[model samples]
Target: MKIGLYFGSFNPIHIGHLVIANHIAEYSDLDEIWFVVTPHNPFKKKSSLLDNYHRLEMVYRATKDYKKLKPSDIEFSLPQPNYTINTLVYLQEKHPGHAFSLIMGEDNLKSFHKWKNYEIILENHHIYVYPRVTKETTETQFDGHEKIHHIKAPIMEISSTFIRKAIKEGKNVKPLFPENVWEYLDEMNFYK
Candidate 1:
């Protein structure tokens, strides 16, 4: 099975995320798209994140209906300050039968050179980059890059940070998340 690892700290999984995952499953040859819920992202500050379990629950709730889209708490058990390289290595060892690839945004392509052992990852695995609102799918940005394949999915401007702010400000987050997904958050008082 070819699994596309879409890693994120889904503070509260939103509709945009669901859309992208569904898009990939339908368009790509990937057998599954795993939402590798990170306990902590080294690039982003710890203050912006919510509890790992709560965030994982939100992801589970949001992705439960879709079989092709699934949530992974793999990082929850692993050490803190999660790095993509380490997670990939762990996953590879755990699921030896499955072929894993990266599912990221085109923006990350710019910083790919700076990632830890990025060349090794590139050589061994494929990276499918979808168009982000800020990142363009242009040749000029990347000079004939072959490892990076462009995924044509809807570019949702909604971000977890923006949604978190709305919830903190006592605004209705019902529309931000999938049906009942926000209800789960409300019941748990996740953001509060």
Candidate 2:
């Protein structure tokens, strides 16, 4: 199976994320797209994040209907401030029968070099880059590289941060996320 890992904090899984994942699964050769809910990202502010389990549950609720789209808690058991390289290495070792690829947006590519063992990741796994609404489709030095593929997926300007802000401001964000996710948020009184 060709599994593409879509890693994120998912502070709350929003439509933008689902759109990208669905697009990659439907349009690309990947057999499955797993939304790897990271427990903690080294680069992101820890204070801004919700509880890891809450984030994971939101992902599960959001992606439950799609057979090809699944949520993963792989990073939860891993070390804190998880790095992509470590997770990829562990996954490769465990799932030798399956092929894995990295799914990311163009914004991540801009700072790809700063990631831990990024060169090793590029050499060992394929990267599918999707366009982000706010980012320009500028060519990176590795744009034409064999391991890096730029896919033209539909871009949504919405973000988890935006959704959180809207919710906190007493704005109805029902249309920004999957139905189950919004219901969970409402029941839990999240971001309010």
Model 1 lDDT per residue over 62-181, tens place? 989998999999988788776788888998999999999999876777788888888778877888888778645444344466767788999989888898888889998798787768
Q: What's the TM-score of every candidate structure?
A: 0.93, 0.97
Q: Which pairs clash in the backbone of model 1?
A: none
Tens digits of per-residue lDDT for model 2 on 1-192? 999999999999998899889999999999999999988788888998899999999999989899899999999899887799999989999999988999988988888988899999998999999987663556677877999988899977888888889999999889988888989999999989
RMSD of 1: 1.8
Report the number of the highest-lDDT candidate: 2
Q: Give the residue spans of candidate 2 off by over 4 A.
A: 135-137
Model 1, 137: alpha-carbon shift in Å?
A: 7.9
lDDT of each: 0.85, 0.91
